[model samples]
Target: MKTIKKLSLLSLMSLSGLGLAQYTPQWTEAPQQIDLVDMTSFKSISQPVNSEQQAVRFHYSLLGSDQLSDNNQGYLAESKQYWLNTNAQKLSQGLQLPVTSDLAVIRINPLNPTKSSQSLNQQDITVQQFDQTLSVDVFADSEQLKATGMPVSDYTVAFNVHTQPGMLTLSMPTATKALAKGDTFIIHVFEPNSEYVLQLKTSQQQYAANQVVKINSQLLSQSGVNHMTIAGYITQPNGEKLTDLSFQQNKNGDYQATIGQLTGQSLAHGLWEVHTIASSDINGLKVMRDVSTAFALSLPTARINQQLAVQSHGLKLGLDVAAAGRYEVSAVLSGINAQGEKQPIAMLMSAAQLNKGQADLTLDLPQDLIRQSGFKGPFVVDHISLKNQSLMVPVQQLSAGIQLMPLGKPMDQDDLR
Candidate 1:
């Protein structure tokens, strides 16, 4: 009767999940967020030093500037490179330059000219706004004159213009001269005592739909300013303004803004931008600067269930999916080796489309791998992670490891499944 009872107990145990030990997944606290874009970047135009006579250089590498500069000419020749830097704008035909003072000095540097050193004279060179001709002076560029292959016409020409309060259009007649395939032009607009640097930053580049975003902007100057203000707004992926950002100066002397609890309500899932403008009154002159930073936003759509099972075939875990999406789970099978030291045996990954609700995913443990690891009784599942392939976002991770009991040997080829 005792033997019969023992046989009955064995049968009950065998009829169960047919695995070894059950384990509860131990997940890490607050998994590190993913980064889909650059976290921190800086862009600033340096002050030209001598403020009274400083000129903001607007340089353009037109047509073939890169090729003619190198012996491998035409190999890399491309169309004109427009000026996209701060404080300068490239118009349809010429440049739209800003003037901050009544008196300004302008310099034009022609590069890779087709004429001889003396063929193109400065008397023929002229600059006009609408229809008025401005007086100009010819000055040989010591740097270009020292250059081996540069023509004299390609040297620097300087001009002093009087009176200006707003934007200035510096244009050359369409019949002045045609540029060579490799030629370029330069325009230097002098804005005296108008250089102030501003830098913008964000805490991270990628944020979940429910996470808050933090931003900071810093302004630097030579002396000090009387009044300074900074403000910004958010632009959605569709190029529509979402909300306004109000920045307050903190104790650390940096302007900071706490974005939001990005929560609820369907959001446009893509790259979002933060555009800011900072203005200051320096020595009675109003200076303003604009800057922008971009970051990626994603939705959390899946999660790994804490209740996991250990079976002879492998490890089985449940997923509590919030949305229907292609989800993936991966883990490292680790166990004690012959030396009584724990080590990784095999890496396993499984992915499938899981609808919202409870779904079972299996991390098949190969019999050969288990046999090779030589674990005596119990094993472990380390570095387990669940990710949404459809949305390409990592939803959950368990780094503390799940303690699993040693799996029983496969019963045959059929058990390998």
Candidate 2:
């Protein structure tokens, strides 16, 4: 496997929170650790909603960030800003249905690359334009489950809005073993009686900004000529071309090239597809056909420098937004303790603005929350917000961390003392 493929695949396995992170509100039901059911986890489930509404009320996600490591372990956080810069056409078209996602990252001590640690947590279920009377519930609690790692079935979500009403509710089978297997997704588009078809494949669907998307293409059925060349272009979700992409043919009838570039004109977030116009010589005649295969671009966020200290009147938060402007930040707690008991705790609602895409601000946390939760340890803090004010499709640039303790030198402020 190539390096990029390995990392993105690893992230997919990590539930690296590409689509968004996970959440656990106080009201929702949570799974208990040490309990084993018929299987470890469910990869995919399908059932008609009990009501007319489809799968709108369902709330599910997992939080993954490289931020907490930067705060405590001196590791550099996720490269989200770079991702956005790479895919930058500011365009949103079509009124899709309700899209609601929330990522609340409870820290995972990667000490044992095998064993994952968990703290008790509370999260809210978010639903947009969703008027579904039916609710579908899957396993949302990855931390508290006996099966510690996230299941591949729960990691990815792919859908296509058809030309006609309704959709094909096809779900890939859950991986029987630890490592995921089989074709996770398939979108069947009927193109009958077409000639000179272009088929494209990539390393993976998910990519970070500035990362090269390894691509390979093959013309289905030789154009009846030994010498034929291929060329293509990338179209943004808004129907604008990011730029033109090209490739060279190898001996195996497959042409190889890198599909995307992080130029000023980006491929954009959301869905971007491959449409190719090939000029082929068929029996001394030129023929062309447009190939139809698409992939998605996802943005991962950067880390925020954060810390917590006891204040005389309340809790003081020192924050730093690494890159980009107008990011939303919030903090909360509630997780499993050493005794394996779930302890739901306080929330330090910290939402502040950053100037020049970066700044340092001292904010206040609810003093009452500090006393009630008795939080002397790390506080689970999540920093993420929608891009371009378009709520339907959000560009995720998140920083999830435990800001209170173990990040830096002992609290020097008098408040902690």
Query: lDDT of all predictions, in order shown?
Result: 0.53, 0.34
**Local distance difference test, candidate 2:** 0.34
Which residue segments of model 1 deviate by more than 4 Å? 1-25, 28-198, 220-228, 261-269, 280-289, 310-317, 329-350, 360-387, 391-417
Please, what is the TM-score per model?
A: 0.43, 0.31
> lDDT by residue for model 2 over 52-116, one digit each (tens)?
21111111112221122221111111110000010001101111221111211111112222211
lDDT (Cα, tens digit) per residue for candidate 1, span 1-417:
898767766665564344333333333343343322211220111111112322111112111112111111111111111122211122125555545456556565555544532233455445554356656643445354547454434455555665344455665433233333344555545434443556677776555555678787776655532245988898876576889999988776778887775522122344577887666666555555666777655445555656566555657777666666566777766666577766666667777766677886788755555554456435666666665665554555544566663244534333322
TM-score of 2: 0.31
Error of 2 at 234 (Å): 2.5
